[model samples]
Target: MHPITTVHYLALSAALLLIGTVGVLTRRNIVIILMSIELILNAVNINLITFSRIWHNMDGQIFAIFVITDAVAEAAVGLGILIALFRNKETVLADEIDLLKW
Candidate 1:
């Protein structure tokens, strides 16, 4: 088998990005949208790590670590908000939880 290359990594990242975008755009569930956002973040991490490997540098890895941290924080906060919304509205659907609408 051919050794894995940056091109392969890029293809994988592209696929993830596509799927995440579709998920976010088409799904109405708030939880699904959050998951799709995480997928997009993961795709970014893959690209950063792949480039770091190609360049033989630590910068990409460092940035990837930061991205991971950010993703974690975002997930925590998002889930907290989702839980609150569910408790108040009794629904997780994006269209149903229109708290912002006046």
Candidate 2:
């Protein structure tokens, strides 16, 4: 069997990102959208680690760590908003949470 290559990793990452983007765009549920966002971030992390391995450098790994940290923070804040919206509107659907409407 041929060994895995950077191209293989890149292809997987691209697929993941496409899935995540589609989910975010097509889903009506806020939670699903948030999960999709995380999926996108994870795809990015995979790319970072893949390049790090290919280049034999630590920078990509370090950048992946930062991306992970940002993902965590985003999840926390997003869930908090979701919870608050649920309490007020009792629905997780993005279209129904319209708090900005007059």
Query: Estimated TM-score per prediction?
Result: 0.93, 0.93
Off by over 4 Å in 1: 99-102
TM-score result, candidate 2:
0.93
Score each candidate by Cα lDDT: 0.94, 0.94
Instruction: Please list all clashing residue pairs in model 1, or write none if there are none.
Output: none
Q: Report the lDDT tens digits of candidate 2 across residue range 59-86.
A: 9999999999999999999999889878
Model 1 over residues 6-88: C-alpha lDDT tens digits?
Answer: 99999999999999999999999989999999999999999999999999999999999999999999999999998998888
Candidate 1: RMSD to truth: 1.4
| lDDT (C-alpha) at residue 42 in model 2 | 93
